[model samples]
Target: MPPSPSTRSQAAAPPRRDRGDACPGALRLHQAADGHLARIRLPAGDLTVRQATALADAADLLGDGHLSLTSRGNAELRGLAEDCGARLATLLRDAGLLPSERHERIRNILASPLAGLDRHTPSDVRRWARELDALLCASESATALSGRFLFVLDDGRGDVAALGGDVSLLAESAGDGAGPAGSALLRVGDDPAALRIAGPDAPRAALTAAEAFLTAAAASGSGAWRVRELPDGHGLTARDVAGALRSAGIEAAYVAEPPAPATRTSPPYADSAAPGIVEGPDGDRALSVLAPLGRLTVAQWRLLTAIADADGSGALRLTPWRGIVLPGLPAATAPDRLAELSAAGLITDPASPWHRLGACTGRPGCAKSRTDVRADATAAVATGTTVPAEAPTGSPPSGVPVSPVGVPVSPAGVPVYWSGCERRCGHPHGTWVDVLATAEGYRVALVDPDTAPTAAPAPARTAAPPAP
Candidate 1:
């Protein structure tokens, strides 16, 4: 759980950094404890099969023979040679993955992964994601945005609405005005208020909201790197952003204190631990596949692309959930293709113990990690000590053996995140079960929805110690 609005305002803040964020990009690699690391941002996580193949090639040739899917729908390559940046960049550019070097770091966009594919969603927010990305890249003011700045386009689904976006456009339901086609609600940061705009104006309004943040950040002169980083009294709001939109010649209507939808839900097929096949907007069916531990070996990558090209659309959409969606599949061929995926060791069953589990780069990859969390998590799963068959997605499974220190162990089934340490990098937003590593063992905690996002008492289980 994260801090509430009031709690955030009153909590102590970390010291301001003297330098800009050093987040890695395709061109600018970061020297991690493991090796050189590069992050490739994929707007709305769209990738052609050919592009994915190229990435696979690059991973084998320049990286550690694997790809890591990030929480923001980006792809990461780790354990690269010091001189691999040039070759990596060339391969990515040839594949159309690197569209703009200057704006690459700023193209942080998260769209509803199932927007057009699911019938519950009214619009294909991915289109708006493209428009917004192009606009942001074209605007000079956007260059001032930090690499951490994020834009979200949730297609009326709650899947990504709570993702802590700096600027967000949530699709409106029919009858919410604008028109029968509905409109979009623009919200800046965590403000309860929002701005209503026609669907057509959504992209521009989102950009304007970002620009407004830049303006306020400059006015405050605190060098705020994010919306929440501004001085307490100078924080931004929906009204200020709406005014900014008006100044930019976009009509904006302020919806002061909008009500949360009574029954907001995640995208359809999101819960299944098995092969998830959904109908696309074009009347074609698509297969949603999960990559265990958010990773794919180069061989797995090539296999996925091959499947997409042969049996489904020639495209792939990488989701923030660490899943890959191969849309545009012919309905008749779905079962066969899905079998191929499952045979290749990819997760295809919703009830699978492997589904919805995550681990950080522990052991040799990260110096800060107390243990090899990945290996420990794997052992926990292999020994039937983790994720059971009956738990719902995102909930903690119970009934594992207690730690040697006499702590009670929860059963494993629900979505659980394993972090090398307490930072909990790459953990999903909202409620989740957490497994944090400690020198003594692993402490499992359920994030209490009632409490202000703190680790509540659960059980402690000893992860198998690293082999000598």
Candidate 2:
């Protein structure tokens, strides 16, 4: 059996949430400086060619013609007219993107982008994601989950599992000598221990754990939107999750020792899958490419959609790395299509400076922004002078991207995020370069996200190391 939540203790307590989360959904639009923004949740990032076309048409007909791919493998439409909400909903409904209006925002689910498509990992996690999504839509009690609440499904590749989800399901290989073949580990919050259950029962176990979180959150009276925010004394453990799973009629075993850590050797939260071609089964291939800064023009979106519709499996998998996976493409034409994508400004090379680069919507889109951070970040990358070739590799203890030696890491090796202000919205989870726009100029420093999974409010600006 797994240890109970009482067995563990935390040093820090997250602040109380006084109000409900205002995260925008397909039906509920968030009013931004540019205009109203709509976030369309795509479970497992799976979308057919027809659905992809619908999104492109919606972008062209309604809001800005650009679709923003989030770090969680979701998409957003900005600069939308508030009155167009009804029309947008109609378009989405017709495209079958909006399955349940009430459960749309809560449908935030991240899975292995290349699961079952390539030979690296043939786990059927996409099926699990779809199953869990349907279960959430049917459960009225699950409507209470916050939009930020995450469900990470990793197909033993350790890609999405390292994302630190509120409820995580890591796929275990068949006959791996761990437990029964085709089983998975269900993790809650930051606790290392997880619940092991049959593969088919993993989705149900995940839902049960989520429902359990809702119950614990209500009892805390803290209005916490996620498990990470359940306060120091309100933590949830694998034992609690196992009991909940049993109540739901799903068999589960506590895994005090989960099969090796689910983290990729390739820098945490960085380019998960390499860019360019990914070899698939039966001599076929898949094209994997990254979007420069996570923004895709309508033309670029259409290009990818066309490839998926004609050359590939008529499907596209939007990865959490702000990239796209075109599966089952012919080994012959896929390379040419990749070249077209590269010419269109997408990052096809893993060594490209734009691999891990990210920026928030600044200037006109956000009223709180002091400058146009997107443009500045772009300009910095264009120059290729963001980092010194001979600069020191080790970073200071306070904050700075550095090399792995002596706990320090290379500054260039760290991802860079351009923030308009201190809020630093949509920043990457791992250590990164903090390029904050100040009154004088850009304040470039190193920043590391809080290791805890809690959703704490942004801290006040404080003194930091000198800019590099």
**Model 1 — TM-score against the truth?**
0.88
Question: Candidate 2, residues 57-173: lDDT per residue as tens digits?
Answer: 989999899999987888888889989998999999999999999899999899988788676666578999999999999999999998889999988777777665899988887
Write model 1 residue lDDT over 295-322, tens digit each, in one string: 8899888888988898776988888878
Top lDDT hit: 2
Off by over 4 Å in 1: 1-11, 175-180, 261-275, 281-283, 386-414, 456-468
The whole-model lDDT of each prediction reads 0.74, 0.77
Give one clash count per candidate, in the order shown: 17, 5
